[model samples]
Target: MWGRRPARGTIVKICGLRTIDALEASIEAGADLAGFVFFEKSPRHLTLDAARALVARAAGRIGMVALTVDADDERLAAIIAAIQPDFLQFHGHEAPERVREAKARFKLPVIKAIGVGGREDLVAAKAYAEADMILYDAKPSPGAARPGGMGRAFDWGLLNEAPREKPWLLSGGLSPETVAEAVRITGAPGVDVSSGVESAPGQKDPSRIAAFLHAARGAAGGEAR
Candidate 1:
């Protein structure tokens, strides 16, 4: 199956995009994917109409990811119909069977997000192997309302020389200042960020976004001239 690949560096996914300006900033800054939050409880959440308008502006310039958390098929259907996203990110407690079902149902790539606080959590992969992609993120605090975008960092060392055969993304607590170090330590093929580039919850800062991409390029050894 053909999918959008990073042009020349580690994949960078800027999530929680709610505005066209931020989306354009992500594209101009050389991001590989733009993520839209569909979970209403998220401060970054956007209505389908809001997401659609912003998506139109993307216009194939970059990949788009629809992020959801334990959403039912009905909600998923609505999101798919409206956003028409290129990828689906399940950031909640979803079994591999659920991931496979979503893929078969939507015919879109599914990125299963796993929260890891320790090396033991990597075992979760056995159940998510069917997903087209995997995203490793810092585990949320107990009873935290949101699954991601919480600015928590995990031990990058856990992923060092780890046995992961599937395409994967490293996320959580990544910012322009620390992204390079995170990449160097973890050797991630891709990185996903949300609150790290924001001035406030759901608010993306353009300069931060640009600096993140530029910095990440350096980390991935694809430094832009």
Candidate 2:
């Protein structure tokens, strides 16, 4: 399993991509995963055609992840039909049972996002032990429509108290500059990034993507630089 041991290299992810150029940048930069948002409310959301095109362009050179927020079976089925992503990331209020159901239905590995605001939120990961991976992201502020990519960071120290049963990715407000510290503080096996590689909302800056990946790799004691 991916989470059984400490990941030697930080699993860099360049997410919220909507263009072929951006996807290519992520692959060329050696990102471990490329993400496409499916929520209509997100500025980064992609149309079915666009998502399929991006997935096709990737051509299995890198792992592809589909990001969805509280989607029902019908919507998930539609997205799965279109992209057939290598991994499914749930960034919503989905219970562990829902995560299990999605995993069984899609037969794809599930990466559940656990929003961390305080020590209490760490408990949520317990319900998702069966998930293929866990993503520890900063909790979105109250009333925020989205569950993640709010560009806010939480206390990395809180993660020290989390039991290391399952592999987890540290996310939220991670950038080229802060990723090393985030890794050092949390000792996370993997890491995920979305807005940190973007020049603006919904716009991926290829240079920033490369820089973030390089930094994350260096932080993980790799030669990505």
TM-score of each: 0.95, 0.95
List candidate 1 segments past 4 Å from native. Answer: 1-7
TM-score, model 2 to reference:
0.95
Per-residue error (Å), model 1, residue 184: 0.3
Stretches of model 2 off by over 4 angstroms after superposition: 4-8
Candidate 1 local lDDT, 44-88, one digit each (tens): 999999988998899689899999999889999999999788999
Q: What is the C-alpha RMSD of each candidate to the true structure, in Å?
A: 1.9, 1.5
Candidate 2 lDDT over 1-225, as tens digits, reads 465323447777777889999999888888878888999999999999999888888866988889999999999999989998888899999899999899888898988998899999988888786688888888988899878848788999999987688667889989888998998888777788878888888889889888888888887787453
Candidate 1: deviation at residue 106, Å?
Answer: 1.2
lDDT of candidate 2?
0.85
- For residue 34, model 1's alpha carbon misses the true position, in angstroms, by 0.3
Candidate 1's TM-score reads 0.95
Number of clashing pairs per prediction, in order: 0, 0
